[model samples]
Target chain A: MSATIHFTIDGVEVTGKAGQTILQAASEAGIYIPRLCAHKDLTPHGSCRVCTVMVNGRPQAACTQPVSDGAIVENETAEIKELRRNLVEMLFVEGNHYCMFCEKSGNCELQALAYRLGIQAPRYPYFFPQRALDATHPDIFIDHNRCILCGRCVRASKELDGKNVFQFIGRGAHKRVGFNAPDGLGHTDAAVSDRFVSICPVGAILKKRVGYAIPVGQRLFDKRPIGSEIEARRAKGK
Target chain B: MSTKPKVATTSLAGCFGCHMSLLDIDDRILKLIELVDFNKSPINDIKKFTDRCLVGIIEGGCSNEENVHVLQDFRKHCDVIIALGDCATMGGLPAMRNHVPLKECLEEAYLKGPTVYNPGGKVPGDAELPLILDKVYPCQEVVKVDLFLPGCPPPADTIWQALVALLNNKPLELPYELIKYD
Candidate 1:
């Protein structure tokens, strides 16, 4: 920590150390800034714009944008909330998210975020795009239908797990997660024990045969909305 | 002739789970009946709409010609159309077949499926049967839905809150606890 960098998130004064991103700073300050793709253990890829914040009137991804001294950050505004909701909806329509039958139903970050945003139904039409499921890996599987292209798994694998197991291939709408090995995930160095295996915010990547273990009401985000724990920190004190 | 606002409901390409959830309101059913008259709802076994309805609660999506026609009729006769449940709002489970071709789906369902016992090896192509669309579509794609109450089947409490608000002509703002997808 170089020095204490103080900032205002939504007009509430918060402080952080040097080199800390707005998200990390806000998380410490107990101000819940909604995000996906930017995990604590992973490098901030900023692919999912769910955590976009206004830094002195400029829209920036909070995860990637480092905190500066006396910076004016707007986390929750009517306009920002609307943009986040729309971005989340795009992620919904862009994939084949059959949440009713999905194993990640309650624990899924995507679903929890949608609920937190009060999005009963997305305004846009469902694309219902064609996607595939890769179950070649005996321990873990990838369902492209639920992938938000957030790059969390990619970052986690390379930066944390130290294995170049996952990578994105193709262009634009055709872009999807591909493996390092010529063969399927089973052929790759990816393992069930990899940190990337547990880093997926959505159910796109899941471990084999362990789904629905937590039960319905006991799952995360079931009792309370996402970010409650972070906000609870603020309620406790400064 | 009751002065109460009339409400009509129908299940299209749905499993009637939403309707079941509506009934799951339990004792509130009496309150709901007191508040609104059943115009064309199956609950009252009324086949035809004898009068214009205040609210038309749609239970599912349009997977066929009949569903489309029924939704169109709702739009015509009802002042407000509420798309109730995931099926009506997002095409729900039936939409899983959207990625596959219609021919393949038909063959899988009517002929090639493991449980199929079609000795005639014939797809049901009767003139009376409604023709299935290429893919299931949400209600909003076909008609203007005034509101959407999403869930597999929105909880009974959720239904009660929404219906009460809608009936009272109040701005619908559901508490976070009442809203859920599954």
Candidate 2:
């Protein structure tokens, strides 16, 4: 039998199984390492480095880094906070993320993270690259302008739904999420019941006819900050 | 004569929703007047800054030459600058046009739009009109902002708290509910 691995995240002692990553350990200990691509239901991609934490004086993506016994992990620090702010800012400018008009205004993970990181405005120049929107699908739509390419939807479509319907197309700056169907989302076998509909962390992929169903001040992260649920669960551990 | 703090406010490239939200302070507006005096603001409809103000609140992003000019004037005349809304803090709804080419945006609005009154294909290129910028820029990009309060139109309570903190010479601490992007 494998022994439990113990680690300290920001000086908080945490324990996890031998195979669990540092993020998983710290998360069980009630410390929320900010991440975009590391979802509970899917395998860690480590594509977004928002969850980078200092381990043994070196920076490492917590989602992918396995927890070792007595590992000293510094997840919250002034330096890390500043780094996250810049990353979030870059994400904001790299796309046409006009949160004021987006249906996912309050519910978006990116937007919530921006608020969490205290990013009033992006310091970088707005790229404003022209993108497209695909509303061909009758039930769902994809607005490419809002896509951050975290690969959550792509991973969910393939690993969970067992239908490799989505894949990343192109390379470098032109790279974007594309479906397997030659005709677009409309022709794809993706259904509303698939995990593909709920895996998107932004307004990029959305279910049609359900925008603003919850209304402002009633949505997730409206009053309660993101990760509060995890933090609450952590408190209950005490 | 009262020794209340003097304040100025302006809106550029933004809907007056922020200004409306400011008035949304409701009955507290009377309390606000008792706390601070308005100088150059749409609320008072003051065309010019009567004198140098202590705090200047900008409620929109810079989308044209005129916006830059006004922002610069505020920077020169005001002691502290506060970006007051999502538009001012980060180019809000107007920044959506940033993706489209400026020429195309103009053409869509003027020459080849769904609703255009002109019989002849003509665009508004009057020399007197303020020249539009290629993309909308948040107030911080154009000016040194001392503070930022972000929201589509920050809740009236948030604005009031910020103003009170500024007047009282204390650090502005906002509650979670007061902080929202929409």
Task: Report the TM-score of chain B alone for all candidates.
Answer: 0.97, 0.96
The alpha-carbon interface RMSD of model 1 comes to 0.9
Residue by residue across A44-78, what tens digits does model 2's lDDT show? 99988999999988999999999899888998899
Error of 1 at A181 (Å): 2.5
- Can you give the DockQ of every candidate in the order shown? 0.81, 0.70
Q: Which ten residues in a row have the lowest lDDT in candidate 1 chain B?
A: B171-180
Per-residue alpha-carbon lDDT of candidate 1 for residues A1-238, written as tens digits (9 for 90 to 100) = 3899998999999999999999999998899999998898877888888999999999999999999998999988999999999999999888988888888889999999999999989999999999988888999999999999999888888899888999999989899999998778989988899999888989999999998898777888877999999999999885
The residue-level lDDT of candidate 2 at B160 comes to: 90
Q: On a 0 to 100 scale, what is the lDDT of residue A20 in model 1?
A: 92
Best by TM-score: 1
Sequence-dependent TM-score of model 2? 0.96
